[model samples]
Target: MHFISHLSAVLALAPLLSLASSAGLVERADDASCILTASGGDDGPIFVDAVQRCETVVIPAETTLSIATGMNMTGLNDRNIDLRGTVKFTDNMTYWINNGFYFEFQDQIAFWMLGGNNLRLFGGGAIDGSGQVWYDAFATNDTLLRPILFTVYQASNVVIEDIKMLNGPEWINFVNEGQNILYDRINISAVSTSVNPAKNTDGWDIYRSDNVVILNSNINNGDDCVSLKPNSTNIIASYLYCNGSHGISVGSLGQYAGVYDIVENFTSTNVHMYNAENGARIKAFAGPGVGAGIVKNVSFSYFTEGNVDDPLVIDQCYMTNATECAAYPSNVYIQDVVFTNFYGTSSGNEKSVVASLACSPDGRCSDISVSNIYLEPPATYGNATYTCQNVNITGNAAYLFGDCATT
Candidate 1:
């Protein structure tokens, strides 16, 4: 799908819709707030009926509430969650690993799963995941499945703003099987005190979601600032400041065989990236029986990075071994990707190449263009190189990493 000539037309076809100013309230039998009594034990029971019974449910700022059990807050409509207190989750690994809601796409699990329509949750309050224990534990036990802090599953018309999330066990937020969601003015941070470090602590992972907007977010984490997982479409991520993380990524898709993944109509703009591994990346699985997928109609523009490695990257052979990748190669296809107005200094960790598009053999990637790129290696690294395999890229070579090495 070549869109070079239709650049203006394609830009005008941005799939994201403007966020609705308001979701008109409906007259319900109970228009009052259900204020829950803070409990030391599981508070899941307190919210069991509040979401269904009242139009507003309040978690007041009086006390520090602890939820020691996994919660399933779903099937709500026209509800507003007014969270004004600090809600902390207990580090009961055994119970949570066994009971958290399972998501098959990424083999992920969630601690507190929330879903509903016309639902809004906004407060200046904080939610703590107590990740130190998980970090230390996962260092020893690789089998440990850390629960995602928050998951919006099977929801629509959701707006979550002005919330503070800290120290999640894994991904901070997961938009799974949801659409028309807006997340704005939110803060997310995951830092571990131990030597293990917080591994895979992504800021947000969107899967099977569409028409979503993530704006004005400040993220300090260890993984992708925002990742579009399989079946994600029509998304916009803007005005983000990310640090100590991987950049905005399209996918590490095609992991499961006999499944087709699609991530399209995505745009990321006005992002400031600092101290990350890569500024922008798209990774897909390789080798036989891995799976098949396509990523198209994507634009990553207006990015500035400092101390980032491989500021632009696309590796279709994500986890597969080198020899196997050469022989079997990835089944996923990538096309119509544009990287524009990017300026950065490479971290110089991998000094061999500052930008890589190592796609699989047999024409799996096409219609890739880059423009207005000004990425230079740090003074310590001397110079940088651009490498490509089995792909043709079009753009201004004088601005990019020189004429790319295509083989």
Candidate 2:
């Protein structure tokens, strides 16, 4: 009974690989334009079929599109798009044919889901990021031109579901300075092997935004599944399966002053991790008065780790340059955090994947609760450890002494 809840997560991470390939050709448009054809009617067979547009399309409610991309619908932020077409990549084999169309899209091709009042991408249509090249570049550390999702900025009321996102570039989806966004039932991946190392393909990067919900998504990448940057609040990531990556995280916050900091009100639950670096982590640098900020009201639960490096972690004084350590307090404030219903096994021979919180004494972690915890890391690995000070954390079997993630 101790390991009951976390044991179920062993089977939770199994993806529907039986499903068909969710990506395909770019569906190239003329002049890289977006084509939009909207038929006005209360409710006639509103259809959005296979069309690669070069310009924007004003798709009203109950309207459907086959499969459209590479275009921006100005003021179409809240439009409902019943993606009724097949959205799959031509093939990942084109990497061999650098002389063909794949080379053009190296710079020309990229699906831009941009500008709308209240936009919807439904009807089971797909959006492939064609991140194969991106993965390769990152693994090899060959290039530094990380791809970006900038044009799709400053839009409100967005919901993308049942859509397949295959092969994301550096940052999968970036929500910039916007609000009310939900990404549900999404399939995002960059599966890795000894030969293929998916690098830096983050699932969701919410930057300077608020009110976001990302749930029921299969995110397997080389970086954090979700990164809450500056001014991000009211964010929730649940029922997530992340594998072969860095893990779910929040931080590198306030890298530079006046970046509109303040990340609060976030919850992450029902998560399954596999072959990752750290299961759950919060890292902040030790720069000149940078890590000092107000980060509060965050909760985590139902976490199951599978063959991971560290099951839990928090590095307050993350140092990029140790020589400049005294520049800032390096003592970040973390409060009102909770972890419950935990269970899972570790990878290799390591049971030492517990909480590693290194917070500053001045303003460390407080008001935290950890209950109903169970960790059975392979039976052969080392034991987990909690490192911190003045933390009020207790409830279930989670051991602590110097744990700063408490009140």
Candidate 3:
């Protein structure tokens, strides 16, 4: 089905879009107040048409719209989606594997993509990914391709708030090539019901986006709470409550060869982390045949952690092995980073080591600062240990690193 082309078309002049009003189907309404319900069939086309033709679309309370196909609802203008009910994707693994929208960066795909200008999607409803089947299938086969729940692609001046996202097969939200976006009061949770856990279900992954703000959210996922991927700048994430996550991170950049990745002017503050792997991290790839990048003017502050494994970290090697990392250092240059006001306890998974700032051997890292770090190891471990390599640190807490190597 084709989307409506002209925004100048009136409600009366719009073509008749078929929406089944059967047992659970939504009744037809005007273009200004279009409401949708499930038709027990593929409601994907109907939902797509409603967003294209209507000025505002509403999914009413107690309603659940079943979507069985991938949707590309991009290039819209001044649209609004009021989701007071639920929009659930059907668990048809075979169909989605063949039809989901592909993204080339990390070889990812999305279930639905919404983008445009002056768009607002706010309602106390949910967008469910029906991910139990995907979770169980991925347990045995690691090569399964799961789709992300929601993606904001090529949009500007958007506000997505007060929404509940559930059971994503992979990532919950992805903001790609967008600008001036704000996500507020968003609650995301992806938990597996069976033996296979919800893996790689990151709360949000921002890539090539600018002026993005994520505030006042609670995320419980398996991967990074919020990750700033390549070319993400001017980003701010604050007042976040992340549990069972991989922390708010920056990069695994410089992975793809010949590509230049950059993350700058990013700040994450007022965060509370619990039972996490790493708290504030910046990771980059290093080795032969990899890309290059720079990370500068970043800050992580006012964080309170509990039982975290590595509360603070900066690893330039990233996924590269230690032997390869020493032989071929990272091409990413890191400078002017600040880590301050951290108060918490480590899980003692590494015994006494609470933080590690391991940069490459070359002059790749400079002007890194640390202060007000009060993270303690378990009682059995005695004292917290901070380790560093090939970087000069300056701050009130610089003594913790204990004679960091100067390249």
TM-score of 3: 0.93
lDDT of each: 0.81, 0.57, 0.89
Off by over 4 Å in 3: 1-29
What number of backbone clashes does candidate 1 have, counting pairs of residues 3 or more apart or in separate chains? 0
Q: Encode model 2's per-residue lDDT on 71-106: one tens digit a residue.
A: 334355224444544333323333312322111112
In candidate 3, what are the lDDT values of residues 1-407, reduced to their tens digit? 11112222223324335456434344455556577777778888888887898787878888888899999999999888888899899999999988999999798989999999978888789999998899999999989999999999999888888999999999999999998888999999998989888999999999998989898999988899999999998999999999999999998899999899999999899999999998999999999999999999999999999999999999999998888998999999999999999999999998999999999997899989999999999999998899999898999999999977733
Residue 113 in model 2: lDDT: 38
C-alpha RMSD in Å of predicted model 1 compared with the true structure: 8.5
Better of 1 and 2 by lDDT: 1
lDDT of 1 at 19: 25
Worst 10 residues of 3 by lDDT: 1-10
Candidate 1 similarity to native, TM-score: 0.89
Q: Total clashing residue pairs per candidate?
A: 0, 42, 0
The C-alpha TM-scores of every prediction are 0.89, 0.72, 0.93
Q: Which ten residues in a row have the lowest lDDT in candidate 1?
A: 2-11
* lDDT for position 48 in model 2: 25
User: Number of the top candidate by lDDT?
Assistant: 3
lDDT of 3 at 50: 79
